[model samples]
Target: MSKSESALALPSRRALFKSRLNNRTLMRQVIARQESRRSRNLSDAAELPPFAVRVLTRMGFGPRRTELAPQSAPNPNQVFSDQFQRSPLLGKDDVAYFESLGRNDDERLERYVDEQLYGNLPDPEWEQRKAAYPASFDTLDEPLSTTYSERECQGFSNYVVPQRQVERAAFARACYSRRQLLELIVDFWHNHFNVFSGGDEDIYVSWAHWDRAVIREHAFGNFHDLVQATAKHPAMLHYLDNYANEAGGFNENYARELFELHTLGAINYLGNTSPLDAPLLAANPYSGLNDPLLDALNISDPARDIQSHYTDNDVYEAAKALTGWRYDDEDIRDENNVCTSGGTGAFFVNEADHDSGGKVILSGGLQNIPADRGALEDGEVAIKLAVYHPGTARYIALKLCQRLIADEPPESVIQAAADTFYANRTEPDQIARTLRTILLSDEFKDPANWGKKIKRPFEYAVSAMRAAQCDYTWRFDDRDTDNFLRTYEGTGQRLYWWRTPDGYADDRAAWMGSTTLVQNWRTVDWLLDENDDSDADRVMRIIDTTLENFPGNPTPRELVAFWCHWILGFTPSGGWVGDVGTYYAHEPTALGRACMQFITQQDFNGEEDSPPFPADQQIPREELRNDDWPNRWHRRLRGMVKLILWSPNFMQR
Candidate 1:
């Protein structure tokens, strides 16, 4: 067998099932190791790192190496050049680009924020890379039924081709795109207005449209526009059972989540109370003004009073208003039993199924829908009322802050972002302005707040690949890529696979568990491994840490230092650098011995370490001075890279 084949082999089904028996013991060991790392980071917290490092890792999927200018440049005495030479792993071009924006950290941060928010930076490389994956982008305009039939005719038994293609493209963008802020915001919105792309055949087949048209288009656009688009999309309609909602048989699934998760959030949820009992607020100026519905209701000064909090009665009324909103499919019909729309995959209101009776919503408010209004008007008004609520602004702002800053961000920043969101409700760049408020706030640049957040599984995986300069092809049929994704699922944060509408938890407590930690470590190994059974030249290697790229023969200590600086971006504490370097000097063959030593010696509940290095068989560093050392230690060096990625320093933002 080839080296890749041996390294990438999978266990049998029975063996995999039997492995579950040991999960309890494995969980304990992972917990202990995490505690040790946490303590060490707290102890070593003194001086703050550079702002560039923080921005690259937290805002984007970490940094990649950049081409350096010649030492004989016009301005060779520039201080950045000296810093770049000292830390060769740092992306010199990236840092220089940020530095050119302003003279200091705060100024540079503001410039960078505006550039990203306005999308002033063009990434031709990402566009060119994305162009290669036509299959991922071309099916967005196709109907779900047509796409499903075509896939079946093409010998695909499953109807998930579009979803898989989208997943591949998303991964590629996260790893390669220079529009880093846009990509991150897109991810945040996808999680916020999440739909299970793999749940149903229609959703699976039309997943491309949901991603491209609904989410990406409105990622930095108005929040109200995004919510309305999500409410009408077929993926969300099917996922939340809104397609079946009608006049006689109302489905409250979409309505409940719209209020609880999407719009006003649970913070404004006053359960099982009369709508009239909720606090009264001033009416939204944009809604209920000169409306035919409210006019027909014969309510004087209908826009005078509005309810602050929503009750169960309000949800029921919202469901009534939202009835008959569905995509253009074969089943849509009018009261005359004639087909109104079909096979278009566009949203349409079925008048036959719509509830047009007179109803009062937000009860003290004059936002009432009179009987016999137009088909789509009621739903539009209802959505406007929810989107314009004060609670919606605060809820969405808090979520954005939680994603970009800390889990529990400072109230000052949240209020500032919320004000921006509310004030710019009618602006095209509402979301962009809100993000600017958060990113440029003093709370964001505070030294004490740095590294307070932990990287999620998606962030960790993409950042590791990016830091190592992984050559990702994003081809759906590649064996190694397939293996990497399957292993990534174990981390429990698979993209678009979140079961509930609330989405994946963003706080540290949700992801700090032992299962998540161990699974993330396993994903690191998968990334470092070579493609199984393929020739070195034929295979698209994920990572290449072999010394063949080095200019000259280097000692074990130097090798350790290079990777540590490359992956962690800053020097780590807790004797990690010295311990790993010493272990490499003593045993060159067992490159990850020191890492395993740290894991085990820290009282990690006696878990058995892998690729076992014998304690008695130590090879001195001088023994590896031959010309063939690079080829001999290529795989072992990858093991060391895995160790660095698994370290706690890499986990922090």
Candidate 2:
């Protein structure tokens, strides 16, 4: 039979079921290994592997497989050299620039950080791949008014399509983008200023605009600009109930989150304390009540100083400042009944609905907004005050440090980053400057800080795909893509689907649950499956195990080493190589024998057979000369790869 025909030979349903059962057993073993590793990591002396391994896994996804040439007889010695030459998936110029960074770790990291921060590098391959998505998705780039009228309210039939397109595009970018640091920063900003796309129909239709205009545009720009853009965006307006905020009725949803979650953080929240009684810094002590209303209230505290902490009064006043800020909706109308709001889905102040009242914000009467300030000036001042506050700077810096360094980063790094953030609050590249300070800090490069964080589900899935060199066609209509997304959702990190304003948790404790781990294993299993038995070309294959990819009859030890370098970015010590090689070589363990029977379609009895080969021993060349060896080896290799992906090493950042 032809090689292709042999590869496509169908297995019986019973056989498939048994294979799945065996996979479950293998998964359990991997989970046990993970638990042991976790215990070790908690120890004071736990050390990470290497610099490249840690940084690549943390800063980007993981080490990607470089495209290899088809060889008649692949030499293992040449594989390491060729892998770093170029990546077929990334732009040639981009790969060249990356390689040109430096020879050593410090030089490479310094150059790479600057390049990513400035975003001067071009990724033609990524751009071309993104352009291949359906042109209908281009409408997402239009203004919210256009999207709302033409797509959400009028012409387009499906409101969910825009959100789906955004989600798919995000996954594609995470998996393939050459500008990995920019992508990582964009993700950080998204979660920081999160607005759930699934919660409101208006948000669903304008989700693309929100992602592009608010998050991606200002990802590395000024934090002040990002916050202002988010405050005015239709998605945020609707998601936070700011759209419903009006004169007589105040909605504190957006305003409260503006303080607690967005800017100052809940760490700065001081509940129900009268502004007059709140404490102030010794450097900036209270002078006198600035607003007449505060004087009229007869609340007096000479010890009270310039607002060091926000009170419940702050949330109330901030809500009043944002009272007139809302998007133009279809329901809005004018005195002449001419749809004066334009149904544009853009931000506009409704003069009639504005509170138009003087407001005292923060304790000790700092930032007093005068009565009847028109054209949304009140809201603008409020946003500026909140975003520029010392607490805001510290809060943002702490979060950034947590994301880039460790879960609980050193106080010295946080203070340094916060100082950078506050110093350049007005610069266009303020965020970039702050990030540079953090990335180049001693804490970031310290080996003790490495492997202290766990990969969230989204990171795990994307890193796996990148490492495996999966041929992912990220089209909405492709069944494999759809199935992949569906299975990924089971791990509980569905993109843009976090219902809460806090977004997904970044702490390790939140994701180390038993259910999440098992679901992740199952997801990897699905990724490596040959979904179509009759058509080998239609399979959802992650890696190709033929001679072209792994030329010659390599011993099981060599095969395990190659994949470990490819996936884990390092070869692990201990008897891991021997144990996995034993499984691939079909040695005499119970699971190994079952896997062998499944792949070779032949049973072996330990009682009747002679002594089994040692785990480190290589499989004989004669046994590899069978007509169906390529097909059988492909099946066996898939199992071994799955185990590697499921390993504790792969689970770390």
Candidate 3:
């Protein structure tokens, strides 16, 4: 029997035929592994080292090639905690992009983050960096070369002009940011309060400000502050048509969402109390509540009479309080484009249009807030009320857990995080501390929940690029940038383009459709190709580095195993060494074949076997030339890379 036949260990000897070199051994092995994995079906997730792998994959993007430590499988909790305490660092591509700016080094935000741990600027530095960006960002940061005084830049509500600097920067950071957890949360928050920039020209201007001045600023801060920032931003005002809201009319858009989507969440009608059936409320059976739909949607509030649950009345009341909030530029463009005391990020109030009449809110408990001048204090009071509402804490906490842990997060985990959020209500890092509690919990580290959340489009692309250590280059053409950006859009979760108010969903079913699932992979060709060609050299270099960094020159098993874990975050079942061994030998240098043979544990007795099959099936062996061999083998490597990336194993988080 041939060496290949012996290695497979087939039950019957009938399959042991001639050792012809054109074998589909590797392909067969892949098929076998797929079948084996189906039967195992994550049965191996909780095992020691695999458990470690599952933790990293779930917590952040799967680890980079150099990050795998099979020798010392670290505890998942320690890894989770360690990431939070460290400061954000610059990534390799970030360093490269900054270096290319020769004289602008001091002005780069990349340097600021590296040296100062935050992205604040003296003035010119921030604007210079913005201007240096590709034109795709212009909609967000137009007048890029010009500088804005700190006071002027503060919520300066200009007109609707959408730009994507934040989206572009976000894409780069996710691919290369050292602060992994922060980036992950930033994305979560953005989606939580989505404003479709494509709605109008106004959103372009408003979203850019919101993305930078608001979302990025408050991402790690208090949940209240985040709620406040979004509540008053012109983008949200315009997205929800609150700008047109006046005494004569009302726009329930922003206010309704503020209670239903942003703060209390759709299902959470109870403001700050647990359900009647909750452990804390076990003593109370019929907690005093007077509303039906509110109670029907949310459990009966134990503190019901004390903390009133919301009703349709609350949405309109909040909207009444928010009257006169609109973009200063659009609101009074004829007035030399002047805005409020605050600029773009600010929600300039048109007092003349304000509902100045004093009124009561919720008509219940402390929830009943007093009215104010031109409804000014009303807006502030409305935001404060919603964010501090107990339901807000639970809603935000549960969503955070869902994003960081599982789709169906355990009640214990949700309650624990909610408790932390409520306890540190005013701390700037309240969200940070709350996340720490959930991330460290056993629920997050549990391997059974490893693949619950699938990667979104931007997340998947950036992470894949980072894993491969991909060198991202851009064509000078704006068209190229648009094409590049379209790949992100292809996943149906494009940033700043969610037309509806609720934004992108964390639910797996939203992105995981029959055709949409494959679109993410189909566009990878552009990401991998250099200058848009089919050459595989860039991938080859990355692979070589991955191979060389190991304890020893890895055989095919060692090489493929490392990537399977590094890229897919799980080890392959039934092993893949033998087929890779056959692939390498088809047309390889003596050294390469030797490495493959070693990985496969094949006997290399220095005796020649039959020559490999011809490269083209159409031509007989006699017609083929020796020179064609190199091309065949290179093609093999491409196949291996694609199979690893496109397989079902890599698709799940």
Candidate 4:
């Protein structure tokens, strides 16, 4: 088989994680979780009915409570496909408020979702709010430095504050955007063309420039446009240390990742070794000879033994090709080291910093542009060559298919998607067209692949908030937004803060650790006001408000059932509704206490107190065991939301 075929055949990060679930430690942890919730609450082993769950979980931020409702459409696929035929822009979901005009109207669901797909949706309230907010969506046309303060940092307050504003808007879009797929695509491109936000204190000034102008602007536009835009974007220029890449010395950081992570993928990169490095490897260097990633991660077979499509010399040549690409505002000394500001600048090439050399790329194509003319032409040519290569199509297609379908997606689907990509190489909607093929394919909608993908921390947090209809406020003035981001501190995905060029891994194994379990459970505060620490009122408001949004006035059992239907997108296990309904029959506080202990205080092992008996059987709430039954029932309802939120089933979507 071919190299691409060999790579695709390899077991993915999910398969690796699945294999490890059988390990003694993981097995014991699962068992302990089961034992703790011994009131017959099955762990992830709980069966969910087919067709109830939607593939939108992988496509967007998962389905909301309303989305989980029985669709009025007789054929759901037709309604879903009608929306995709149009183009998509960014969503205008306010992170602080769940309300969007017509979002709650059952009849306008497809119409609303369709309009957002093309960015044709009218969000009058959002427009008004944008006019009032200082975050300047106008950065799409200019540099972020110019939009914010061009002045130097004073304790980084100005930089961070505006950056936080952009971040809040981004989070809001993820949580409430009608254009879920569009936001998801933008996120994919952002990570693909990632520039760490925390690297240089000054970088925050250029954050929106990169996000708005480069990534988001060209997200659905074209493959060539996106690559070229990111390669020249100031945030990326500085992040990869390409700004310092001069004629005498070259940094292969950006060029290497451009091939390894962005376009060709690590499987095709072949490392920094070339025929010239044969002498170095044969002589034995001072450091570890074996690949650290291969060993430490324990990847076997084909993935461990990948064929190199390009070598280190090619990366060096690529860096030389990209030389002199720098932003304005850089200090320049014309002669005698006299420094003067170039002022706030756009992308431009400096001939003095460029390496005037003929180079051979991976395809053995000669790039011999004369130094006297076309200084920036070779870099552009090189990017075009890389993007159009057959490997790039396959690699990029695999990722698109992986993120949309299962981690170990079927080879048939990948080949089909890659075909679409190559066929639409010059089209404006190249990536979108490719995604459309994969998304609408039988592979994506197949029952086998429904929950195959795992939810990253960002997806989890946003989906939970979306389902709960969270009235979150990330305003710096209130400090809630700071706390929101902090909650993601050690979690799976921290938006825009990754320092490395590889960006965040799509691999679920990279995230599913023991400690992350508790953290994931603790983050259910978005669902209910339990963590609000208020004496009263918030719980009742949350419970009452959430129930009111649903169809009928549901009792405790029916409420639990509706939530199970909404949150899990399926019915609960056999005894679940009865357990919740019977226990929360009158005073819901008992249900609250049960779920909190099951979630908040639970850990990896059964090293704590014995499991509590069924509330209906032992210590009924009528006695008000330790607290007033009537007073605390609202608190118990909060606990119910938490229980559903923290379930392993919810973790998958």
Top TM-score model: 2
- Model 1, 121-207: lDDT tens digits are 656666776677665455655655566445422323345777887787778888777778888888988888878877876687668
Each candidate: RMSD: 8.5, 8.4, 11.2, 12.5
Model 1 has a clash total of 0
Kindly list the per-residue Cα lDDT of model 3 for residues 361-441, writing each as its tens digit. Answer: 443423344434556666776666567667778889889888877678889999999999877776877876787678667
Off by over 4 Å in 1: 1-31, 35-48, 66-93, 133-158, 282-303, 331-342, 365-367, 532-549, 571-632
Q: Once model 2 is optimally superposed onto the true structure by TM-score, how far is the C-alpha of residue 193 displaced, in angstroms?
A: 1.3
lDDT (10s digit) by residue, model 2, range 1-653: 32212221234434444443255655565465444444344312222445656666767776665543222232334332222224343332232234444565676577677766774666665577767765535655777676666556432345566777778877778777777888788888889888888987788888888888889899989887899999998889999998888888999999999999999998887899888888765643212423233333322244434577888899999999899787866744458664333266788888777888987876476546678776388788677768867788899999999998888999999999999998787789999999999988889889878767778888887788777766554656567778888888989988898988998888877777766787788787877773523225533343343333445556556555666555665444442243553443333222223233333332233232323233344544334333233235444566666766765567665
Runs in model 4 deviating more than 4 A are 1-44, 49-52, 65-119, 123-145, 148-155, 271-308, 330-342, 365-373, 530-541, 546-555, 570-631
Error of 3 at 405 (Å): 1.0
What TM-score, computed on C-alpha atoms, does each candidate reach?
0.79, 0.81, 0.68, 0.73
Measured by TM-score, how close is model 1 to the native structure?
A: 0.79
lDDT of 4: 0.56
| Model 4 lDDT per residue over 1-653, tens place | 42212211222223323332122232234434533433321223334433324545666786654222223424333333334223221231121111121233333333333443554545443345455554444443455546433432334665555455566667767765566777888888877877788787556767766677777778767887889888887678888988778778888888888888777777665555663432211211111323232233232122222222667766777888888888775554557775432246477888888887765555333333334333487677557546765668889999888777767899999999999987787788887778777866778767666555557777887778776656543344435556656766657567888878877888656556555555555555533553444424232134544445444433445445555555655543453445542433232232232232221222123333433233333222332212243224444445556656655556664
- Order by lDDT, highest first: 2, 1, 4, 3
For each candidate, what is the lDDT?
0.66, 0.67, 0.53, 0.56
Error of 2 at 112 (Å): 0.6
Tell how far residue 484 is off in model 4, in angstroms. 2.3
